[model samples]
Target: MTADARPSLAALSAPLVARLIDDAPALRLGIERVGGARVVDAGIRHPGGLEAGRRIAELCMGGLGRATLGAVPGTAAWPFGVTVHSAQPVLACLASQYAGWSLSHGDFFALGSGPGRALARQEALFDELGYTNAADNAAFVLEVDKPPPAELVAHIASTCAIAPDNLTLVLTPTQSLAGTVQVVARVLEVALHKVHALGFPLDRVVDGIGMAPLPPPGGGFLTAMGRTNDAILYGGTVQLHVTGPDVEAEELANRLPSSASRDHGRPFAEVFAAVKGDFYAIDSMLFSPARVTVTALDSGHSFHAGTLAPELVERSFTHVP
Candidate 1:
């Protein structure tokens, strides 16, 4: 399809919404009417269970990718992993999966992602891609422990140019099973964001696939957050197929991994605590997959950077002594 003819992510993902709603009872994802908006509590205020978390992870990709549970090699404590693959990686990952926007109101905050971002068009990254969608309905994923207020829902509807009833909000907390699965599912997204940050043209990226281990659940918010971040920073691996100049693709591959950051040696939780829990204080470059491989489709040349830190992965996943 031509760039201008591309469908809105929200429109493209509507089927997944219907599927989730239809399987709501089985998935343990509770759906309810809140302020005329349809709210799916995947984790917050609901167990969301494991199946729901897996489905939500897929939904976060705007239904453009598949997210399934698998095993990460050499990891016994948190052996399960979230695997993601997508033909529309740019649209599904960077434009949809990456939580690039912070949605906040008085005493309320959530990192917003999913197809709703395309409708909001508030991020500067959207402008750079020349991508926007005019969908009559919208879907958003919020990582928070509490349901949003009615006013917040109304504000989202207005921003998306849709009626409150036409909006869908999926909520998941970082401490929950669903939240952890969805966050680790960002392996491909994290890689794309790093490449974009390094000034690579995203349109050249034709496909992406990635995998990162899912840590066992039990810890509270901070610990869960740490393990999820560690999963990507220490265990994740991403491969992108691009139809671009060989030199540029090689350069991107060289600079794309998390090890490229000076803060690569320690567990992410330690790094977080070192910054006194101020997320912004940590180096932005530290947020990426452990290994990245970029292949130039035109020249059949490939380049790789970084290596998986299984020791740190063990420390973070198991909290071992």
Candidate 2:
């Protein structure tokens, strides 16, 4: 946590780090430059950036065309481009966790200060097939854009050489934020899911979406997958939170899990800490699953894609060399 301090990977939150494999097509990565050096709003303005959900899903499932396209009108560009000196810290940290998934030249901020370029190779194949996964993908816009025009969408699809159906548009605002930063945050979250759902097998498509309006189990907002108790993308920043036993409770007990020991990873304690965590983790790990798992643990409980709150879960760590 110091200028001269160098932390190992284990010191970093697992959800906060990710990797992009060259072979996996289901995980198309999308990144756009924004206004801030640190936490500035620099999303794709022109042609906007790739839809987060769409690009990643395309990368994961395959059968999609090129992952990104555009520079079209109304989409704002980072005129001054990115400030590397300003973003050096996050850039370094993100590069470490997401090195493989990142563009070859460096971070998206690198894309600015010049014409845009696809950082990753254009055409690659996956070696694992089904296990194909993606890590460290991010898309950020200062102010969200509306869905591009039809022609623009077609052009983007053409640029990527994919059909219109295969594409999901990044949104823009015709109006103003009106102090509606919270709404922007919620929409950003929903956008991550809807687009990702496009790549799911037909039977699994239901898992790809949900707004937060409907009352969730126990009337909660954080529903699983596409189901939620409230309309997401509302008028406030939405913070995704999770904390559980690192290893299964049973497994922990077998070791030092004496019932008398303290719950170092209590959900309440973790949630309280999460409440204070900055957008650093909020932006990158909200939708990511590495830190927590989602399982439809109960078959009888019908989830229009229902999710079991990770709070009910526990974890155990095993050392392996």
Reference-based TM-score of each model = 0.96, 0.22
For 1-321, candidate 1 gives per-residue lDDT tens digits of 576876668877888888988998887778888789999988766687767777887788888889989787645666779899999998898788878778888999988899888888889988887788888888888988888888889988999899999999999888789888888888898888887888788888899999999887636888888889999999999999998699888888888899889888899889999999898888888889998899999999999998988899988877832
Give candidate 1 misplaced runs (Cα > 4 Å).
74-77
lDDT of 1 at 277: 84
**Deviation of model 2 at 93, angstroms:** 28
What is the per-residue lDDT of model 2 for residues 1-321, given as tens digits with 9 covering 90 to 100?
Answer: 332352222222221212222211332323321121111121223221223322322222121112122221111221111001111112121212111221111121111100000112221311211112222222212223322234433443344344445333222221222102112123222322322322321112122111122111111112121121111211111111112332332221122111111322233224324657442333321232111112122232211112223222211001111
Off by over 4 Å in 2: 1-158, 162-171, 174-209, 213-298, 302-321
Candidate 2, residue 48: how far the Cα is off, in Å: 18
Quick one: how many clashes does candidate 1 have? 0
Clashing residue pairs in candidate 1 (N, C-alpha, C atoms within 3 angstroms): none
